[model samples]
Target: MGDRFEKLQDRLRDWTKADLPGEIWHSVDLFDQDDYDILVVPSFSVDQQVGEKIEGFLHYEERLLFSLIRLRNPHTRVIYVTALPLCPIVIDYYLQLLPGIPFSHARERLLPISLYDGSLKPLSKKILERPRLVDKIRRALRPNKAYMVCYNCTELERKLSLELDIPLLAASPDLLHWGSKSGSREIFAECNIPFPDGSFTVTSTEELLEELYELWLRQPDLKRIVVKLNEGFSGEGNALLDLRPILDYAPDKCERVETINALDKQLQNLSCQAEGETWESFSKRIPKLGAIVEAFIEGEVKRSPSVQGYIRPTKEVEILSTHDQILGGADGQVYMGCHFPADAAYRLKLQDLGLKVGEALAARGAMERYSVDFITVQHPETNEWDIQAIEINLRKGGTTHPFMTLKLLTNGNFDYDTGLFLSQQDQEKHYIATDNLQKEQYRGLLPNDLMDIIAEKRLHFDSSSRTGSVFHLMGALSEFGKLGLTSIGNSMEEAEEIYERVEAVLDEETKNYGDRASSLPLNWDKA
Candidate 1:
């Protein structure tokens, strides 16, 4: 890959806003004073969406940052924004997601995003090669001396930099070093951070079975364990170990008297996957692809968790923590949108430990924004709270990045010392919808055309055009499906009303668009 990129740089001339294949929100706040020393640009999607998956990694943000610094202000100094890291733990957590209460028209009503109708993802044969993209980026920047495009590279970043003559910001400088589950465990031990008790870190399949046997010995009653890969992301890289894999070898793992069929039935209840589902529909799409399984703890406290922290440029832990639910999971869940100061009640419990984790990274000399996850549990006997660290994402999270973009356009003074982003003008936010579009469908829309659609306050399809009048989800019901959404409202009632309206609009649009199959994500402004 590195060799490929190096070869390409000699031929390409990167320019500003060279129309790329995938969706990009190359946005800038019209209201920003243009005063900040370093401006971090948002990146392109990690991979270009192929069929069902967006394969490979490329630092789209790095390409943008390099170009921006040279053109925007090369000598001044800047840091390219990094992409958020996802939990490999939940990647492919469940094969089939059980529909929530309103299962009626929910499937029928969804806007074709989830309906698996042998609709093969028409991924480009030309994947977004990072090295090639970097070559294009170098042509755009023409920088005299390279500084750094900040991010934790995972194959994608390395080639992009080597090809472009750009310095890769080793996230070793940021908490990206803490991306390892083991590193997270250590942060917990060294600082007494609260989190799940991980018994072991198994690397190979044998070690995995040995640990499982040991866990059974230590707590023989424990039946299932949650296994995840150290390098996995989103919900694509994980599995829940049942008796089946070992059933063929060690019948003991499956009770001989109860028989393998009985063991299969039991494991079946753990997931929604049916025996008939296709390979694409299977959970843990790529098995034998490395995993990290731990004791599966069952509990009543199902609410999600988050805690935001920042390591300053000076390398200090001086930031407040904010938290939220991982709102969108298999059940129509996307990452997060809602955020609030860590609840007052849990403050004291998480504060010291949160700081300890932040400081640990700072001591390692990586200073930037990062967030951690944990589940707060009440002791079975004492009813006491124990907030445990799930893992640390070494880069900016979904909540932090978009909000900062809003901050640039708002009237608030962002106190970097204190993680509080003061809402400037009664809060106006961009309702960003990062959805995948069949490139063919989006045949004529331009960046401005999409913005124009948004500006019109129309949330349904234009009957004549056969495209999105506004294809957004019913904010209320969105959370039930995998690609969920929640309206962040000042009042819950208003949020409810918004959700209702979003649904009403969808119903009407569905009736209208069903009559005609329109080209999606049409780059209308393109020539």
Candidate 2:
């Protein structure tokens, strides 16, 4: 139980911060100080270097963690992985919504450039500033190749990688094709699987309305009409186009239907709720970079599974696990959290489908660690299970380390004979990092701040005193914060319990900072 995230994108980005509660790693300072090579990161274009604003992106700190291994052993090589073009349209969306950003001025005239999320930027924008950002990095990291930009292999990525002489990871464009709603539709059709009837693309509302009519004609009992962007994430760029009440468009062409007046009434009703994300605004937010659209399916959220595979040598390993995205609630929030394997009933099926999908993707020139998400539902009439693809995240997903951390911590072995991920008696329990540091400001508190707080909260883990009933597995915190201070414990419950304890410590420190701010020195204005 850690910070819950409202959006999945938020969750992936926040994991880089140091104070993530429940995580075993205490401080990022240790990670920074450690000498290593090959730092994997998100848009090194936005990284901070040894102060001085580090002037142009370098590497996301999380991927930079590998510097730890390299520092310990210089023979190590690091590979940073990047993903698809976010969307080539979201740029205008943000400008329209939050006009304060610098890019707002030129938004109106941003022709020939669509938005793409986090794909660095649209080709046009990148073309404008590429020289400056690239030049800055070239100067800063020139001596011995400080870092490499593992961009997704889109046309831009390919061009950039060639110019920089750095190896790019999964090409965004090709992988993106696998993630399209239409792509998924094709896959479903080939597999003879059932999915919500959907249009390949709907550029205008006219086409949208027409598609709605067609779907209605095909399946009159359908209750939900999901609208999705060509490229999107989490649940963004999606809406339920409720057409039940407003189905009178082109009534003459079909059997008797609701009148035009009813359609107008429905539009009026929609106007009341239309204040949220608009098509025009939502369209631009598509990504100053890359995005895809899809049909939104209705059902309980299920199976946040990822099938991990690596391609330099081409190996496929499907670690099918269920995940709960920790979307820190509204406002500036933290995004990250706990993931475990899927439920018993559907675990096997999920893993199997994931393998099939993963292989299919890898075969189509997208042969790396690709993740495909799906939701399963039962046909109302047949009661048969149906697993529908959600979106394919063809990159290293959140499930990467949680499962690996579990592997590193576990001493037990799995039994292939039993077709189980672990042996029958293999012990599997322990961990805690759900320490919420945001509720309370993380003021000037040092590493020991949390340990002391957990002690006060009576949450310290003592291996010798630990009973299998309370806690059973363990590791020791060698440093504990910043530059690699580690925390170890036995039992997942104990790990979680300790996290809660230290959370209060963060809260306390934040409160102290608040007090200090209010009572500052009166003569402090000399500067």
TM-score of each: 0.57, 0.57
Clashes of each: 44, 77
User: Global lDDT of each model?
Assistant: 0.40, 0.38
TM-score of 1: 0.57
Give a tens-digit lDDT track for model 1, residues 146-224. Answer: 3233333444444445545554433432233366666677777777766654444555544554555555445545555
Model 1 poorest 10 in a row by lDDT: 90-99
Model 1 lDDT on a 0 to 1 scale: 0.40
**Where is the poorest 10-residue window by lDDT in model 2?**
467-476
Off by over 4 Å in 1: 1-136, 142-151, 162-170, 173-177, 220-223, 242-290, 327-344, 347-352, 378-384, 413-421, 425-453, 458-504, 515-527
Q: What CA RMSD would you report for each candidate?
A: 13.3, 14.8
